[model samples]
Target: MNIRNLAATFVIALFGFFTLNLGLDYGLRNTVPHVLQRRLLNRVTADVVAIGNSVIASGFDVAAFDRASGMHSINAGLGAAEFAQQYVAWKLVTNERTDIKQVVFGTFDYSVTNTKPTKWTTWHSNNALPFYADPSWSIRYGCASRADEVVYLLARRVPLFTERGGLWTKVETLRRYLGGVGFPAAQINRFGRISDSKLLLEQNTEVFERLGRSIVETRVPLVDPVADLLKEAQQKGIASFMVLMPLPADRRSFYAMPGWKAYVVYLRELLSQTGTRLIEATEWSDSREDFADFVHLSEIGAAKFSTRLSEAMQCAK
Candidate 1:
């Protein structure tokens, strides 16, 4: 190609890229949910803050917990968040707040042990945006290598890179709406869509059984970011507890496995070293009607579970 033609093509590409980035930055910053999430992170002052992935987001009934415990609480859970993102949410929400007396982390099998940093291009990036936007934090907890650190640092400065997840979120939202158009309307709450929590132990029994067996066989170890969360909470004199959120009947049966029992014993020992209590609420709810899916609690279940959690906390105190 001619030099002039190549130059013109390059200029057009640059302009398009700049315009796309500008549009994405504006759209992501102004979205209602994103704005509200930011507001919650900055303004929420509660006696308790619960942080985790979607399980906590969809399962923790903040209002029920508040009513039952007579203490205000915020569910700072983020869908698809990993341990690093969960830690970031806690840090951002509790950074200057002295009113937060306790922090509850909702976890399931191997969640605490999975320390993989979220990708900046996927939907999960939205959950980790607060920390990934900061080069230092992204470097400290996100990137696994020097090359990754460089990319994270660059993504921190570029809206096109960092907000890719927001764009994907928009896409997913549209897809869900379209996909559900012909189906009966889904039951949704403030947390999002709810699945019918039925007590069908036979449904997906094999999947859960295999998952349990795999977990028992793999025996993953705890990672640094999770340990950091517990240690930091201890250092700040805030109570930190990791609750093993309710599981389906098929999944719960794995607890009886000898390997799984041994793994839990080791996990408890590690948690004790950091003064973090591991609360096993796995068998808290047995009925399938309490679950939104295989792992999360439905609205009814969330209310019931939150009340029980409040009682558990009171007894712990």
Candidate 2:
């Protein structure tokens, strides 16, 4: 082809790409779960907000907690979240309303010690938090760098440049449905993607022990993102508390490990410094029946835990 024809084709292709990218980006911005979450955050009035990962996503029954505590509550838990995402959720809620008097963070050993930002990992787009997160807040919390900010801005304009976890999650759901066409339906919780449900079974005794040891031995700095989150909550006059949610029966054995106990002691000291309270509820429910899988609580379990959590807060006060 002549240079004139090639140039014309290139321009047309680029235009098509931009058109498609922007179209998808617009649709995604309106359709994702964060749109609904943002709407809720705007109007949500609560005395307490629960923030964390899948554990709290499935474990914190807002209705039960409200009923038990005699105070309104909202669960802003995000699946696949760490402190970075939790901090963003905190910012979103606090920025929108002044009713939040207490912030309850649900955690496990792995999450409590994880200082890295979610944007640095493959799970960045595991949920719609990235789409809703403020670019400046992300950088302020060390969740995203300047390069990441550029990419985030590009994603806002052209979502095709962003991670495709949401689309891939849908594709994976379809694949799982096709594969399980004739089998008994798997009991899955609503907190995370169906594709990730099997992850619970993979965390065996050995894996739990190793993870515990790593968490205990990891040299975390005195003030990391988790502490930063607690400190920020305190600065806003919102009391912060971390609840160590209960695990499955056998998995709770790790709590008895020497390293695990030491980690808890260290964690309590850290929380004390930040004016955050640490609630140890790991042994609250020893029944394997309470868990949906390995770590997340079932509906029944959530109701029980939420009530107990309310009482614990009352007692602490």
Candidate 3:
């Protein structure tokens, strides 16, 4: 074939490929995560919107929160989410609705302030970025290290490599619809808190030391974006609270690292300065039976912790 004909054919093929991928993304995005989230939000009409990584998603039970506080709640939790993704999810929810009276932001060792930008981008950028239109410099720079995600997605047309990729994501969504998964009351209750005292102490000692070292090595800066979002929520008349959810006893030690206590102190100061409420549920020193893992809670643990949390919020008022 002549050069002109070959060029024309290549252009046509490229157009077809781009069109096919765009169509797939459009369909899957709307059908999978977006649709599931929309349904949950619709049913919620929640006064308290719980936002965080899987810890919040799996740990906080909407039914328990409602029973405890008489406040309808929605758990907008994603596992392994960084501050950038949390910020994106928060922005998306708040932008679309105005009824959320409070937002509970969960903190962990792997959040934006503690991990590198590249790490943040790799794990959180794709699932989180769709919420904003032309994200600001802060968002861009915070995710600057994640340029590889862009390259990977563009080249491979895949974001996550789990069995639930592309169309398979819809299967997970359908399973949730059929009550196969999402937030199971049984799993929540089963894994909400730790029950073994000896295990708790033994685990925490090792976990805390490693956690401290991770913080020092990464030099993870404090994530100002979360605080800024809380401030915005307050200005809009929405109350916001920062909660350091209980990790398994061993996991809580990470906060005891050399500068860990100082970090929490700084966060508390920031919350105070911003007029946001801070709930320190990290005081698991005496509680051995309330955790399931270093970071997750068993059902009994969730119940106990939720009760304490509800009482604290009430007393604060």
Candidate number achieving the greatest lDDT relative to the actual structure: 2
Q: Model 2 off-target regions past 4 Å?
A: 29-33, 115-124, 140-152, 177-187, 191-219
Q: TM-scores for all candidates?
A: 0.81, 0.85, 0.67
lDDT of 1 by residue, 156-219 (tens): 6677766666677679889999999989988765445545333323245455455445655675
Local accuracy of candidate 3 as per-residue lDDT tens digits, 1-317: 99999999999998886677666555556532355356554554668888877667666777777798988877777655556666666766776687888888876543435534433333322243433223542345344446744643343333232112445545755764688445543333322223322332324545556665555555544566676678788788887787887765545445566656755665666677667787878764346666555566666776776667777778765
Cα deviation of 167, candidate 2, in Å: 1.7
lDDT (Cα atoms) of all candidates against the true structure: 0.72, 0.72, 0.60
* Model 3 misplaced regions, further than 4 Å: 30-32, 35-37, 40-44, 109-112, 118-221, 252-258, 285-293
**Residue runs of model 1 more than 4 Å from their true location after superposition:** 1-5, 30-37, 115-125, 128-133, 169-220
Name the lDDT value of residue 86 in candidate 2: 68
Rank list by TM-score: 2, 1, 3
Q: How accurate is candidate 1 locally (lDDT)?
A: 0.72
Model 3 TM: 0.67
Backbone clash pairs in model 1 (N, Cα, C under 3 Å; residues 3+ apart or in different chains), count: 3
lDDT of 2 by residue, 143-250 (tens): 356776665566644466443555676788899899889998766666544446546443565666675566656756433556777888888898888999987777
Cα error, candidate 3, residue 291 (Å): 4.5
lDDT (C-alpha) at residue 213 in model 1: 54
